[model samples]
Target: MKRAYVLVTADKMSIRKAAWQCGVPIQTLRDRLERGVNQARPLGGDPLLSRSEEEGLVKHIEYLAKCGYPLTRKDVINLATETAIFLKKRPQNAGNLSKRWFVRFMSRWPELRLAKAQKLSMKRAKATSDETVQSYFQELDRILTKYDIKNKPHLIYNVDETGFQMEHTPSKVVGPRGLKLNAITSERGPTTTLLACGNAVGTCLPPYFVFKGARYDARLMAGAVPGSKCSMSKSGWSNGNIFKHFLEEHFIPFLPQRKPDDHVLLLYDGHTSHISIPLIELAKEHKIILFVLPPHTSHVLQPLDVGLFKPLKTFQNACGARMRESPGEVITRYDVCNLASKSFLKAFTPINFINSFRKTGIFPFNPQEIDQTMFEPAKNLARNHWQTEGEEESVEKGNMEKLNQFFSSRLPTPKEPKSHPKKRKVSYRPGGVAITEETIILKIRKVYADGDDAHIHPDNSLGEVSGEGRKRANVTQEESDSDDETDDVCCVCNKFSPDGLNKLNYLKIVDWAQCDLCNHWVHLEFCDRRNVNDIRSGPYRCIHCVSLEE
Candidate 1:
């Protein structure tokens, strides 16, 4: 048809001759000529969105996915419907786009595809940034160079602890269609902690087990591999004392012989239990370099986590499933050691250990081994510094308006206006830090010296309160202040007066109302009151009281 149209326009042939030769209808040829080639349209009717609009929406979806916020099918439909309504292309009463439209939309865009999203915690998503991963590799490189052990894969070791539950998740089975299939498993069981240590050269130390009990039990070691160690913690998890014992007894003894002047690089997560004054001293004494991965990043940077533990858990579950087949038998902690030992032997192979180190870029020291896509989720977190106050306010206001409009159209009018959602406070920390004898020993000693602050805080291991805890402490301090001058501060904004005055004369000058429930004083503006007459009209309630009542 295009050829026919060009032939007729070029005057090489008549419209009827061009149509006959090109096997095109005469009416179609005439229509094409009248409309011009560039103005030709698709065979079907006009689409709901223009070509540019659809492209824009596609870009929006891609951007959200890159920011770790992928939208579902329904979310896309609602977004399209809302966009049509905003553009005056659809009626206000028209509901969201139909499933048929979603199907067609997916077909139109070849780049988009349905996928199952993996679950990742917000903390992990934010922590697995490029900056953090790079910093960790930098520190690791420095340690390897300083110790002159870059080529000595046997000297580089990673140690981490993983937990196994008695109840195993059942895998798929072949069964008759429409019939219920049941897999037997224990009702509930205690978790057993396994501390695993492996080197880049594919050598693993004897596994250590920690069971939950008041005292160590001899029976728990049944069916365990030779030289494996066992101890008991109150929660079946490793603590400072348990870790210290593991290092002193099991790790150091089983570690391969090295030269007296050679230094060993030990990589582990920065768990509170793994850091103590005694542990630091032990590492220093052994000429071992203790390196802690950045917080919440073990999933990406730790060798054991990147390769070994996952398969070990799979084998452990298979072993547990087989044991469940026994008649009227319940798997206990005694059985866990046997099951773990079986899985450990199969999973802790030389190839697995070597692959784990290579995957995490540890032994070979390649920082580029980490995929760039893994860091996309953290891009938004890092971009917070680039957003301006006006941009934030505009975004918040736009979201509020959209929500209010949606609710108003479906439900009855609300009595009171809904408040804005509280913004979550994200605390940032250093990308990574190396724990050396001189860098950490004195800090640990100072924390120990302060008797009241001796307890190890898990997030930082410095015995200091966390960000949320500090916020609570500040609120408590403000509430407990007995000074008369500070008593009249507004509870919501924490200001003395609306005019920013603390003088008693100014307090009277400004219209302040006290909450009848909490007896907290707040400014009239905060209470949604215009003046003293507004407060006199009804009982004044603070924002906090209103929120609680709602």
Candidate 2:
């Protein structure tokens, strides 16, 4: 108990007070505190039983617990009876136990031990970039960039294909404006695939459609060839099957039928077939030049690689609109073939194909300079209100005045101050004259194919500079586009602005337009804004893309 007094005194109290509060005499507490030792309780004279009997009782209690007997006074009594009989044979203690019976004991007690304390070491490490293997393609890309085509125009074919499965992945989505906070989102999907192969001068080598069946194979590849192993994989989407089939079939057959000297140059990705043994042998034999782009560079390098796929997807979704009544919505192998035919035909029709490519801006040069855009959610450009089943145009809900007022808030508007007037400037230069134009031509810089940056002068006047020294016009959309609707899309990415539905006088940041199909901004143009042109472009997010390249 004196040990308890020390603990009490440790909490900001005198030993005398602690002892007093603990109801122990100061002298007794003082005697116990002479050393850090706890005293066993003093024994009183036990006239009831002897010490040997009490020890025997403890042993019996332990025996009863070990024997699976429930602890009770009766159990202890029976155990003691049996133990006493055993003790009759051999008794341990001969000491008097008259005073031992005065105390009580618990069955179990906790055992304590000392624990060792130690310290641990912590260190950090670094790693190299994960794309070490993929970089080899970059060198390959340089070789292709310099390699010339066999024929000037007609014989040069960028023959390639693509594939897809109907699967959706978890993707993060964003919300519209005006929320205190916007959370990310996810969605499920319908899917499709398109394969486009064509030449540099806007001629298609014969596009293929992607299907899930086994119609694609080595023989398919052989059929795609004219007579030799090298041919267009346009027999089907760019798959392992078509990859093999092209080397086996159409590749060499598609060679110049008329001009023996005419050779075909194939610009495609590094799919297995393009580099496979069969295809390689055919190329060497037939002198077919195969140019496969670098890894992660296809969307920016190939013409159809960017924006044309969106229309293909849109077409698939159109086909998928048919409801499935049974376990099969599977378009038959034949149906797939038919769909592939139609999709390729409609998607690659010369005019549509060129328009799509123009939108993507992959046509010219500087593949590294092209935008990487993924597909965007297709919006119905169809107006909300209609005249009736027979109506041709949308109903005008409001008057021109309201419409003008509504549009005024959407774009950067030219200002005429009502409360503040312009101040006259004081002459500072010795010439005594100042440049007083409200416009300044901003130079747009472009990267040339020769790896040099050149500036193109824009026709707009940069009125004032922001705090960051950046210049932008306060021009309204009505004044900027004047008569064109295509300019309503973003000039940087062909995406509708965050405030696009409401924002006015859309400003073009880069010299390009976004493809609605690809949903990316591309095709840096020198065309007049008054007569804007539409083109296909890939869209990139982390990187700008005309498609879901990453």
At residue 180, give the lDDT of candidate 2.
52
Highest TM-score model number: 1
**Tens digits of per-residue lDDT for model 2 on 96-164?**
222222223222111211223211111000001123212423533333344433225444555544443
lDDT by residue (220-302, candidate 1, tens digit) is 99988899998776556666787778888988887789998898888877654466666778988998888877877777888
Give, for candidate 1, the lowest lDDT window spanning 10 residues. 475-484
TM-score of 1: 0.63
**Per-model TM-score versus the true fold:** 0.63, 0.32
| Shift in Å, residue 267, candidate 2 | 1.3
Candidate number of the best lDDT: 1
Report the Cα lDDT for residue 266, model 1.
Answer: 85
